[model samples]
Target: MPPTVGERAPDFESLLCTGETFRSTRLDEALDGGCVLVFSAFSFSAIAENWWKRYERAGWADFDVPVLGVTRDGPYAQNAFLRYLESPFRLFSDVDGRVGEAYDLLVEREGMANTTTSWRAVFVLDADRTVTYAWVADDWISPVPREEVEEAVAQL
Candidate 1:
């Protein structure tokens, strides 16, 4: 199961894609006032593209907290995806799925033997790394609850 509200979020270290380059980032070190952590399957999928576009249109960058994305894709693919979207937020490369596993977001799709991907999920964390809010998609393509996330950030 995933971390619940009021619980300390699992800390992780991964390669962060900054559009131009990659850098090692630790979850605890990245926290400022608060942050929204997004976990998704593939960076290049249509669903993922639409997800990022939706956030862009919703003015997600204007929120009080920083938003970060994570996927199992390599840093190279993540860099390209971030560049292509012209996204304001950075993406972390969880290539080994260790981050996903730590967050309990890893899922094995039906009919895809030995293949595991991070489930679509979002976590709002305070500077102390405590989870303020958590949401996991019921299915692969469910849309993120942007308004709720915005409200959560506003409370930070």
Candidate 2:
């Protein structure tokens, strides 16, 4: 099962596509004094880009909560997608799907492995790595509305 609202979030590290060597970011460390929003997606997909744009444009990054984008794509594709969207948030590469599997966000159906790729999902985590909210979309085009994320952060 996926992490629930009150459950502890799984901590994982990934490579950032910052051109230099990938940096390690521990979820618990990142949220040591604030909340975090983790978005799991396939790079540059319409829904992912659109939602990320909205959230960033709203200045969520400047707030106490940090937003993270995690994807199964390698650093190359992830960097390209971030450049295309002009997103300031760092994107994490989960090429092995270990991060997604740890969070139980991988969905394999009809012999197609969305787990091996990326599907739209979001997790809100508190400072101690406890999950405050979690959402995994059934369709790539659908995302938890921006307000929901805002509310989650506010609640944190």
| Winner by lDDT | 1
TM-score of 2: 0.84
lDDT for 90 in candidate 1 is: 87
Against the true structure, candidate 1 reaches a TM-score of 0.96
* TM-scores vs. true structure, each candidate: 0.96, 0.84
Candidate 2: which pairs clash? none
**Residues 1-156, model 1: lDDT tens digits:** 999899999998999888899999998777778899999999989999999989989998777777899998999999999999988888999999999999888889789898899889999999998999999998998889998998888888
In terms of TM-score, which candidate is strongest?
1
Tens-digit lDDT track of model 2 for 1-156: 778888988888777665333566676655645565555667766767777787788787876777777887788888778778777777788888888888777766446655455457777788887788777777767656667777888887
Judged by whole-model lDDT over C-alpha atoms, candidate 2 comes out at 0.73
- Worst ten-residue run, lDDT, model 2? 109-118
Quote the lDDT for 84 in model 1. Answer: 95
- Name model 2 segments beyond 4 Å from true: 18-21, 109-115
